[model samples]
Target: MSDTAQAAPPDAGAPPRTGHWKLIGPGIVAAATGVGAGDLVATLIAGSRFGYALLWAAVVGCIVKIALAEGSARYHLATGSTILDGWRSLGRWTSWYFGIYILIWGFVYGATAMSATALPLAALFPFLPLWAWAMIAGLVSAAFVALNRYEVFETVMKLLIGVMFVIVVAVAIMVLPNVGAALRGLIPTVPAGSAIYTLGLIGGVGGTITMAAYGYWVNAKGWRSPAWMGIMRLDNRVAYAVTGIFVVAMLIIGAELLYTAQIALTEGDRGLLDLREVLADRFGPTVATIFLVGFFATAMSSILGVWQGVSLLFADFVRNIRGGTESREELTTSPAFRFYLFWLTIPPMALLAFGRPFGLVVVYGALGAFFMPFLAITLIWLLNSSRVPKEWRNGWLSNTLLGGAALLFIVLSIAEIARLITG
Candidate 1:
């Protein structure tokens, strides 16, 4: 098919449209996938250290992600091609970077996701050790992704986010947050010594490699052409709006419950467990238990999302590498997909038992740091070039947002690499 012929929607003259709420799927999956336990913990730390001072950062982070996700989906719809295809058009180097990145990143991230998911479960049900719980979480996520198709996976993600939303917001409300302070937080101001936290909150809210997987989710949701552009944009915005709320709610919890009391949390996912104890002391066992459930929902959703979404990405990579033309649906069931599913589940469990290797951790950190910038720069290149239809090319607003995102990620990447080297 001619380029224009392939790019044109089946119904060429359809009216412009907006998304109906019922059509929201890929965005939820993307949002759920992106906002993992680490993002929440970072926001929590920001709130604890500088109560509501960095709230604007969370809001801006969401906006940045919305731009990134929207750009990704727009490419998919405008060109009737995968993001991997767009990358391939850039150069063979894109393939090499992605191939190496996905392999190393997935192996490390698998353990991280499993460990994050296991934390709350271990806290809530202490009968099982953390490693065992991590293993179970990994296996269960693998099984769910293996058995279900995109529709089922999306439904489950929606349900998980629902549980996450209600419980987290409820906890925030229970804290009786300082409304005036929160409102004041809308004004951007960086307090002394808060530069790192401010940068992290702004650049790390929902940023992840999964942001690049967004187009795959959009494609899996059966949106193949530009006719779905309006809905896609709506879906993307709504998803990040929800993410903003989650981050804000966690910040409120930290501000009201921890900051006021001068209680310091242990770092990492364990910090959440510390918050659980605080909740139990301040409220009761029931409230602490509820927060743990929300924590599990948040972490488990990430596991499910990565297992499914990134597998789709890896499968697409394999298909493109082989010069195969498998439909998105077929890619889900393809051996490449299952192999990644296993790659993300089984091999990583070893990390749980033996501890993450120092060298592997450094490489994972380096690659993970660079991925967001890579994605943002590549999207700008792909969307602005002839690879995309002229009518569908990014406007000034999209370009500005994406350009800013690229700059922000580049800074964060340098910081991460510097940290790795210094340590």
Candidate 2:
């Protein structure tokens, strides 16, 4: 967090339903955003390859994210400053880096997210090609955010999350996983030849630049005082708890369904499609369609989350640069916010048609890989600094978690970069 100027209170109309479980909005948004199409594929792959071998690692991943998110939302409410404002206090360079990062990151991710979300929809409605469905997905997601206030956006996200949860749990139960093996998988042993994946699973669960957007969401949700801290903590835990279960459910499906059959899935988003085929063959099209709907929810939630959350960062960035103040309402409706929403949805449509360029993919991969480490490092600095109130500063446990996250991500970043370069 930066020693940035404190923010003013949000416009005085909305009620603060502090301490209520119903007030758990932003954490849900962040969790849904974190567990996107890529994460789903990764979790599924983990299960197929090592039937619950890394379940303990998944548990660790959730704990680390809980710490990071707790620190982030804590900073927001404690300081009443957006994460952008905090970063700016470090130096103008932080703003410049984020500005460029969001531009490139959003461009590439918009296309990928749209395509991923559209896959099941396209399969369900093959009258249109994948690209056509991608376009529709992008447009529909954009319109959803543009139309909804934060409250409505959160409500819709919760609804989708319910659908996602029910389907994933249903699939896991259908697979009839061995209860004994799964319990032992929770014993924290890392099998040989699985170190890289173990680390990746542990470090990558429910994370991305959306981790940073957490603070913005907290701010947008009217949880702006230290008094709201306990509520934020509860909300953060519940969010990642949902994420933890979703990952585990997919793992169970992979372990029991695919592992027994000795199935190998393709890499990336396409793997989910392959799984859909397998599911349809084994369980019928109706069951497969239900799972696909869950897949759509996973991908589309990210689209909506980035649409609302990252654009909030853009609004804050512009506000800091111009040395002006804007209420939360103004930021949401600001041209900067809406423009990035358009940036994320529209220009990427071209990538859907022409296909992504090699260089663009490399850039996106490199930037995306580095963000966790960047966030981990900056968060440790911010939470320990004078910018946040002393009482709200990180305790030793938080420090240990953030430090471990930074170190873990540094290793993951190097591995990802090496893979991109060799390919």
Candidate 3:
């Protein structure tokens, strides 16, 4: 990959003028993959503690992510190169950072994702132990990704998104959210002792390393050039808007049911199980069961998305580092892709039995903490450079948002590292 901008695809013509709605696959995948159990828990905890005070943070979080996702996809569309290619052009150091981060991140994340996915299932059906359910979920997700291509994967993700939207939003409405209070929450007031919760709600909504994979997914969706920029922006915005809805819905549940009752949930994924128990007690087992089903959909979607999206990333990383010339479309079936999918599925099962090693957890947290900042900083570097065509160079608005995101993630990373050290 050269620093000079690659020529646009021959098909690059006038940007699509109609049917923008049809160009929505990658954003859906990005959203499904980005929002997992932990995000839901974070927003729920914020609402439980502070009522509707941090609603502004959730909306801001969505906007921050929209900026990040759009910037990443824009680089790919404008440069006729993958995000990894842009990183390669930056220097060898980017590769070193990513290489170390992806390996450690995937190992810990595999066990974490499997456990989160298995939580709802184990709660719903206790015949199988949590570990057994986790292993089954991991294996099934691996198989699903292994057997399907991007089109099939996108179809399943869309279906899961529909399920999540219907169920979670339905439950929030059932709680009869105070319209006036939720409206007032949009004012951005932070109550005493709620600063960290406010930051978490603002920073945690639908954010993940999979965000960097948005470009690969954009390619996989057959939108390979600058002509698709309009639809891509539309797709990115719509996806995060849906993500905002999910975050708000979870916050509503927490404020109405738990905050009002003065109830506290156990920390981590188990908090969701606690919510199910509360739902069962208050609304009956039927609604609780439905929520459990929705939880499975949320967790499973993350599994499928990571297994597919991040694998595409790992595959690209390998190709870039090895100087391989395989096209982006071929990455899904590449040996490197299969190896990463396997890495994400099998080896992490050991952690399920023995538990995450303290050292590994420290490294994972440190690396994961800085990833978003790294992404923000790099996009600002890449998009403003000679690599991207001048016509597609980021405007002042993009620069400001990306700058804010960098500062925000840097703050969050420092906070995360402090927490790990103290613990």
What TM-score goes with each of the models? 0.95, 0.95, 0.96
**Tens-digit lDDT string for candidate 2 (159-278):** 888889888998999989899999999999888888888988888879688888898778777767788888789899999999999989989988998888889988888889999989
Model 1 is weakest, by summed lDDT over 10 consecutive residues, at 1-10
Please give the lDDT score for candidate 3. 0.90
Better of 1 and 3 by lDDT: 3
User: Compared with the true structure, what per-residue lDDT tens digits does model 3 show for residues 1-423?
Assistant: 221122112343555677778768899899988999888888888889899988999999999999999999999999899999999998999999999999999999999999999999998899999999999999999988887767788999999988988999999999999989999999989899997788777777785799999998888777888888889999999999999999999999999998999899888888899999999999999999999999999999999999988998999999999999988767877889889999999999999999999999999999999999999999999999999999999899999999999999999999999999999
Better of 1 and 2 by lDDT: 1
Q: Flag clash pairs in model 3.
A: none
The model with the greatest TM-score is: 3
Off by over 4 Å in 3: 1-16
Give the range where candidate 2 is weakest over 10 consecutive residues by summed lDDT: 1-10
lDDT of 1 by residue, 1-423 (tens): 123321212332443454378888899899998888888888888888899999998899899999999999899999988899999989999999999999999999999999999999998889999999999999999998887766778899999999999999999999998999999999999999998898798788785888888988877776788988888898899899999999999999988888888888887778888888999998999999999999999999999999988998999999989999887657777889889999999999899999999999999999989999999999999999998999999999999999999999999999999999999
The lDDT values for all models are 0.89, 0.85, 0.90
